[model samples]
Target: MSESTTDAATTASDDDAVAAASSSPGLSRRGLLGLALGGGVAGLAVGVGAGVAGGVALGRARAAEEAQTAYDFFGAHQAGITTPVQEHLHFASFDMMPRTDRDDLISLLQDWSYAASRITQGLEVSATGAVGGDAEEPPDDTGEAQGLPAAGLTITIGFGPSLFENEDGDRYGIADRRPQALERLPPFVGDDLDPAHSQGDLCIQACADDPQVAVHAIRNLSRIAFGRARLRWSQLGFGKTSRTTSAQATPRNLFGFKDGTANILADDAKALEQNVWVAVSDEPGWMAGGSYLVARKIAMLIETWDRVRLSEQDAIIGREKGSGAPLSGGDEFTEPKFSGTAIDANSHVRLAHPDQNDGIRILRRGFNYVDGNNELGRLAAGLFFLSYQRDPQQFIALQKRLSTDLMSEYIRHVGSGIWAVPPGAASGSYVGAGLFA
Candidate 1:
């Protein structure tokens, strides 16, 4: 939630606040008096400068709402991977533009980190976020990449500036990632979503034990950042994806049979480079800590997918059982190419198509999800695909090509979220510490 949007929330009417507090025994007389005084002062201030200043603050807050989600790599996310997570809460977010600051917006975003330091519980592993494989790499024994249970849950927020906040002023300027872009997504049914989200100077991400807690943290985080700007636009989700669960049900999306198996795995350069390469730290330069961008819709259909014969399902994804690999051979991170086209007319890449040069190759940080409950009876639930590309065009091209993937039969396109992850930084430094240059 951005400051502007949260400001738009309905507060108890002044009349109501006073009357209710006076009548109900919940709030003490002193507390009620303080509340009314604060409201009156705020109302007077808003009424007075409610034009230019208010507009700019709202604009600043709204500008922060561009949705850029990406999951953290093993080193930075999920401590003790040695222990299987009964449920994992992973969502990837990155800024569309990493270094966007019209004026002091950068400073405000930085300040948010300082203040946020007070509420968190975890060790943060920051890596330089440059992509494009700078001509160097981190030391093989750098120790910058292992044993992270001590690291803790962190809020990794990225910023994107080039994306439109609002084409016009006043009404829409307060939203980032212009609401206009949302029109492109296949309708997900709900109509209440804000067409555009412009909030905060920086995007805020919070994850924890419960999915709901993540949402709660996001809403409260506004107060810290809102001290300087407004909260206008934002979105939130909770918990690790369903596929990470032991549920076995592993619901597929609009497509079917365990989508998104090819990308995820333990860290190994040779194993994943064909898919996406993890940035190797080069000790102390731009390449210190960076990652590649991997994005794909890789759709799925739950109803039909669950019913398909296991053999057919394994073929769609090259993996033996969707542990995420190739039918030709190897487990999740093993080096198994979509090779051997002679055996099957449709190779895994022939089915998925990302291996073809024209398609985009982003670093994939996707996870599965299930919304609504038993009473509500879950609707569609599948991979919430996230990719971090040095350039958006790369990922966009990949999405276009995947339209032909065989998996499309089981998956229906819905809910598209994008984010740009900034290069990593030492814990004390702010998220976009390097981009200003």
Candidate 2:
């Protein structure tokens, strides 16, 4: 419950003071429950009136407990990566303004980190947030999420390859420190990527149970960016396609098949260490505890897919639609039997399975998205695929293998990007500060 964090505007030695100054008083479940039981003497004094008050307090405490699903902003690794996937996502990419210097970059990070720490705790971007600021000035917060709980919100920031070096030529002077595996992903077999949505210098992944809370995080953070960084392209997603904990039931994609059944869970630290977190022995030591992020905007042809025969649909996905079990038999978690015709030779499950890919695995954290209707009256909907791994090659290999998947006939890879997710910020410091160190 300590929830230690930092202040973006100041880097003093007293981290507790800085955190207290930035954070609002959180109404935790324990605190509220204690409040319900604390009015003992006063309750006895009022007799029946006290009983009525106690009932109201107990009810409020239960509601607050259900709403208070918070995570710390400061840790060994950034939250949201392995955190149980949230119900909604507001993923945004940003580019540092032209002619920005190293100091500008550092200051921007400091400010972002400070704001993230507060907002993730269900507080505002600053102490004078929303209605607390001067009447004449714009409030630090956008105010949409006022009176809301944390709802398990998490804000994760990543550094795109362009941030280290770009067409502008080492704008921040740390070009040599760029990770070898942190380059733009090579063109895939059938990528119709839009230049506008493809890449950026930075990416922020904000997720929460409440759509408004997720949107509020990005809205306020984008506002804070102001002159330092500009929004490139953003995505709003719902119905997570993957879950990071065993407690969560596997969610389905737009195509209606259970997705991420074999996903890496938060409890699997061994798999994470082996396949997700970058090791200290790896190159570019600044990213030792960090991971690589790959995002792909896949437009699913649900209309076309919907018309296919049920048998054909099952064949394409290599799983039973109802139970999510592999065609080879057994329940959802059954190791797929690819040896027989039960599973198609070119089925999605077969091709993307780790058994066929040399044990290569990436932790998936994707979500389903819809961009309204297109001119043809078709829903511009798709799967926003997000995966994190120790190296970018893990994604590249799996994607290359899936190029031949039967499901590929109904999906198109549009927006794509790769970013280096630095480790978490320590107390009293901003994220990615070690890059400057």
Candidate 3:
């Protein structure tokens, strides 16, 4: 997870940290060293006491280890798109409040970027946010994540089509700058989309290994938005369904089968350039290094799916139940043989394969979600499908082809959104800063 996206120096440090943490015998000595590296000395000097040095060192050492999982919030591209998938996700959508103008929009993005930078580093939204502020006034931070480590948090922000213009017209004076592909997704064949959960003027995706940390990031950012933007809808998800690096194991969705086996990994720079990141030479130069994000809230009919026979399930997925190998093939990572009837033509694997889609590919970062039981006592659970592509047409074409997918009978697309995620902010700038430039 650490090797592909980061610099060589960062990778080497991560390896050493992992090695030290794994060696049981060197734990104590290494813990103390890690503590010092992680800022434990300040605590000791501030009267933590020499007597409890060992205990304090151990605690900080664990925190330092967690820090190894952290990714820089400001980078060549947004962190969450290609960063290692975390175990939890808190995705939110927002709409600009009525009559809000260009300044409000710009300030909101600036505030969100500032807060995200601190939160990803395991700090409060501001240095004096949670508790350091005046006792008489409300705290800038919500305080739920007080003592927690960063836990690999990444907060990615994006702009929906409505941000540039809406029914009233160019609200932010950037309608001319909007990419041609940035528009509401056309209704798909089997879509049962709910308007309440569909589009937004902005979106924030907060992911972390710890649920509280993830929630906290969104909560505080939501607070910062205040009258500028209001939350449209949000979803909490867990059990990541995709992997961005080979070091990660392919995760399973709510369904029993493995998912995203052929996803674009971070190490595949060529594939990323071709299918994921936008180039400066592309139509919208502001979106260079960025990607289009499509989010679908697919609701699964658990009771029906549970009753399907095991053999039929395998046939629908085009893979073995025990191992994720292709029906015609070897192990999980083996290239699937799709030429013959060995794999069903209508199977998900066959239809969604790159070969079937004109060699097109996408980077997936999906998660499984359970929203408790419905009124009929049925489980309300499904996959929150998220994919980043260089262009919106990549997803539109894929979905058009999957309209005939056999598995569609057991699932419904209830929510949909598409956002043009801007490239990472340089120091002292905000996400989407180029739109106003």
Angstrom error at residue 334, model 1: 5.8
User: Where in model 1 is the C-alpha error above 4 Å?
Assistant: 1-104, 122-151, 161-202, 207-216, 227-300, 322-325, 329-355, 358-361, 373-378, 425-429, 433-437
Q: Which stretches of candidate 2 lie over 4 Å from their true place?
A: 1-66
> What is every candidate's alpha-carbon RMSD to the true fold?
18.5, 10.9, 10.5
Candidate 3, after superposition: displacement of residue 296 in Å? Answer: 0.2
Candidate 1, poorest ten consecutive residues by summed lDDT: 41-50
Ranking by lDDT: 2, 3, 1
Worst 10 residues of 2 by lDDT: 41-50
lDDT tens digits, residue span 1-437, model 2 = 32211111122223543464255333223222222233231111100112225557777775455357777677778888888788788899999988778987887787777777777777777666778867775555668889987777888999998999888899998999899999899999879999899889999999887777888888767766666677898988888999888878999998889999999887887899899999899988989878999999999887999899988999999999989999999999889988788999899999999999999999999988888888999989999999999999999999899889999899999999999999887756778988999
- Tell me the TM-score of each prediction against the true structure: 0.50, 0.87, 0.87
TM-score winner between candidates 1 and 3:
3
Deviation of model 3 at 365, angstroms: 0.4
> For model 3, what is the error of residue 247's alpha carbon versus the real structure, in angstroms, after optimal superposition?
0.1
**Candidate 3 on 1-437: residue-level lDDT in tens?**
12234311132243443332222121122222221233211111011112325568776775466544655566678889888788789999999989888888877787777667667767677656578877776666768788876788888898999888889898888999999989899989779999998989899999887778888887777777766777898988888999998878998877799998999988889999999999989978989989999999999999999999998999999998779999998999998998788889899898899899999899999998888899999998999999999999999999988978888899999999999999987755678888889
lDDT tens digits, residues 1-437, model 1? 11110111122333432332222122222222322232222110001112225557665543222111112211222121211121224332222223333433545444444323322222111111112223354211112213222122335564433223533332213243222212222333221223343222234445443343233334333433332334434333322333221222333333333443443333433433333322443222332233322222323456567788877766665455646546556654455555574224343445444556454444444455554333445444555555544444555555555555555576655434443345544444554455444
Candidate 3, run of 10 with poorest lDDT? 40-49
